[model samples]
Target: MKRIMRALRRCLAVTAVLAAAFSLPATDAFASPTAPASPTPVVGGKRAAQGEFPFMVRLSMGCGGALYTQQIVLTAAHCVDGSGANTSITATGGVVDLQSSSAIKVKSTKVLQAPGYNGKGKDWALIKLAKPINQPTLKIATTTAYNSGTFTIAGWGATREGGGQQRYLNKATVPFVNDADCKKAYGDDLVPGDEICAGYLDQGGVDTCQGDSGGPMFRMDDAGAWIQVGIVSWGNGCAEPGYPGVYSEVSTFAAAIAQAASNL
Candidate 1:
């Protein structure tokens, strides 16, 4: 596989504070008992209620994210890769210090970001939780290509034009993108073993925004088990035509993630 392509404009676009710029051209004032408090800029990153591996962070603005799971808090290689002397980033738990905490404990003692993963492309990372993934099942895929068509990506990041929400998960849909369009959108930029291509060309609806990095791009089976197929790494403008969003194909890095998990 042509693993390396164009690197994500080096996370500049992904981490850019553009979400605050997202605004509707025209709209009517909505009504509410009290003025809607501006969306709180996610300080330690946002997340759903709570899950074993559910975690994410921004590498810009405040320029940091809180890791949730000690076992696996995925991240962009650029933000927390071998670049750091510590094999992977250190999280203190909670929304901030995801590395260590007596109250909020999640540990794997091992952090693994792809060795070759840089800001270039395919920036993927994995944290081997402290304990075994004894949950029911969240199967890992080893196939390099995405046979699955549709998938959903959720994050607690800023919307089209803003950020700062402490909670409340945000999401978008993604359709598989072919190599041709991938190159057109980002030529010689996709890094191998780092990034995989994905986005909607027809539906015109799904895309990843800020604060979405390190989150799962999951495929839903009839059984309803959300199988992680990709990781939200980066993308072009909020939503662009022809150019769909790109992700780090999870299967391609399954071995690394699995190996890291085994240590726990």
Candidate 2:
């Protein structure tokens, strides 16, 4: 709940730095790879327990995702290439520690990226596993009702800016930032209704950084069920002042994601 965090996009990190240093326009980049890549870790977060987040998934290509169904994973569209047959991606779940013996691994058979994702907004995606994962699936929010307030974010991304990934899962909490304020910080880069912002805007600290891309931004519902509201998308830096972390507003694309999952 109290830590440094940022969106995990290796290329985006570099792009953000350049944009800041040179006063150039920001660009969004895909964080995942076509081949097997190292996973990233979360910084300044509390280590998660063995099964605290059963739906949490570690993508081989340096991102995170959530199990949407027995054989479907909901992630960021940028975490994968355009939706189609994809046999190179892998998903690991059921354990907080990447090296834990009880971890479950599954290969991906296909991917369904958002229909109109062009390196910008509409950054949600669905991945189909080769086989069903014997674990609980996470519930996703369908309306903007869950988009506000404090939310829980977890991942195996870097523990600090430009630091190495972690072996165990990290969990933290961040407050929601309104669109006006978010737009003031990101300008045209902040896509209203398509993206949600969360982090410490004033003091800076606590965010999901590089490697946490495609991960879920979730919170409990009134009935005590966890509902995912956003997907880690991009940010200027890891917990930098005035630049809150950006996420794909799941509510805006819930219907499309559901339809995509059914086809997958």
Best by TM-score: 2
TM-score, candidate 2, is 0.85
Instruction: Name model 2 segments beyond 4 Å from true.
Output: 1-41
- lDDT, candidate 2, equals 0.78
Highest lDDT, which number?
A: 2
List TM-scores for all candidates, in order: 0.62, 0.85
Candidate 1: regions farther than 4 A off:
1-70, 81-110, 128-137, 144-146, 191-194, 202-205
Clashes of each: 39, 17
Error of 2 at 180 (Å): 0.5
lDDT of 2 by residue, 1-264 (tens): 011122335222354442332242212122222322333335445767888899999887767899999899998877776878999888999998676689889999999889978767898889899998898999999998888889999987765566445557889889999999999998887789999999889987788886788999999998999999999998887878898889999989989888988888
Query: What does the lDDT read for residue 234 in candidate 2?
Result: 85
Q: Local error of candidate 2 at 32, Å?
A: 24
Cα lDDT tens digits, model 1, 1-264, are: 232222332132343333432221211111121424333222122234434334433332212232323345555554443532243223333332222132244333455567765456546665544453332334545775444587766654544423332234444556677666677777776554555677766544456655556656767655765577776666665455666667777777777766654553
Worst lDDT run of 10 residues, candidate 1, spans 24-33
